[model samples]
Target: MSELLQFVFSGITVGAVYALVALGFTIIFNASGVVNFAQGEFVMLGGMITVFAHAAGLPLPLAALIAIVVTAAVGVALNRLAIEPARGAPVVSLIIITIGASIFIRGASQLIFDKQIHSFPAFSGDDPIHVLGATILMQSLWVIGGALAVFAGLWLFFTKTLLGRAVLATSNNRMAAQLVGINTKFVMTLSFALSAAIGAFGGVLVTPITLTAYDVGLALALKGFAAAMLGGMGNPKGALVGGLLLGLLEALTAGYLSSQYKDAAAFVIILAVLFFMPQGLFGRKSTDRV
Candidate 1:
């Protein structure tokens, strides 16, 4: 029982990170039909930048803040420089562009930051608290808390804020949004910034536990993309559920089955979900407007 509980706790922590990454994917996908493959680079940047900044003598909070800001700016630049110019390009072209951008960012990260794994002190000391016979780390609490806060904040922004409504309008129909005086292009930029910031924040919160390296982004991107697909491509709620489910599945597989195949579990589930429900678990069925 304790072992089961331990796996559950670990799963939740990992799920929180996956959820944040999925949220980032949803934000950009909603605003622009293009899936930003470089999204994972923001996570890598967050963790790598924070680690270096903290090592350079900055306070942890300040280091994280800098990482978020820089990553947000990079997100904006990516939209403006690469995606925007390639507007109307083939989906294949756009995918290549984003993937290329991710590779570029990873290369840059390697050059700028030494090729070493780095971690910072957890927000709270690494104290373990027992829960139902399972021990939980304080860092895990921080990761879970950060994920929840981001979800709540995004919910409020989308449902209550006028700016968020503008974003929603843009997503629903760019032409209609422009006709109604919304700057759809600006909305796209904003979405990218918001998504990147969230990804970076996830890195900042989880790095103490996961550690960070320039090459870590690709795997994270793949997992996050899977989570987003599992939840329903553009549905925020689906992303959240999919992420948590994937994490739990991986954890249980590791605990009960074989630790070596934990990574395989997530991919297998993704394939299974797609095979059964092509539109995704929460995705809406689209009909052509004749």
Candidate 2:
């Protein structure tokens, strides 16, 4: 039981990061029918920038805040410079553009930040806290708490805010939204900004545990994309559940199977889930908007 509980704790921590990534995917997908593969780079930028900022004598909290803002600006630039120009292009082309952007960001990061793995002081001390005979790190709690808080906050935003309603309206029908005086272009920009900010926050929370480097974004992006797909492509609630579930399964796999196979094991299960339920756990019909 102790061993099982430990695995669950580990899974939840990493799963929280994946959930953040999935949420990023969900937001961009909702706004622009295209998957932003570059989302992981935003997370990478968050951690990298925070590390460098802290190293340069800025307080850790301030560093993290800067990372988030900078990454958000980068996201906005991506939309304006790359996506907006290709507005009427095929979705596949837009996706390919994002892939190109990911490569560009990775290369740029290597030049700008070097190739060193980096991390910062955890929000809480590294001492493990014991619960039910299992030990959990303080940072893990931060990750899980941060993810849940963001989820709840997003739920409230989508339900209550006028801008949020405009997002929903645009997602439902861009033409109709514009007819009703909604700024569809602004909605797309907001989506990218929000998505990038979430990704950066996840990087800030998880960097103490996982460390960070210029090249870490690809795997994170793939895993996050898997989580989103597993849950239901455009559903926020589904993204949250899928991310946590994926994390749990990955933990269990690493514990019972082998850590070497952990990634493969988790992905294989996701494949099975997708094969059986193409629309995912919370997905509605194809016609339904986020």
> Where in model 2 is the C-alpha error above 4 Å?
287-290
Which ranges in model 1 have alpha carbons more than 4 Å from their true place? none
**Model number with the top lDDT:** 2
Per-residue lDDT over 1-290 for candidate 1, one digit per residue giving the tens place of the 0 to 100 score: 99999999999899989999999999999998988788889999999999999999999999999999999999999999999999999999999999999999999999999789899998989889999999999999999999999999999999999999999999999999999999998999999999999999999999998898999998888888889999999999988888888889889999999999999987897798789997788999978888
How would you encode candidate 2's per-residue C-alpha lDDT over 190-288 as one tens digit per residue?
999999999999999999999999999998988898899889999998899889989998999999988888898557856887789878889986764
lDDT of 2: 0.93
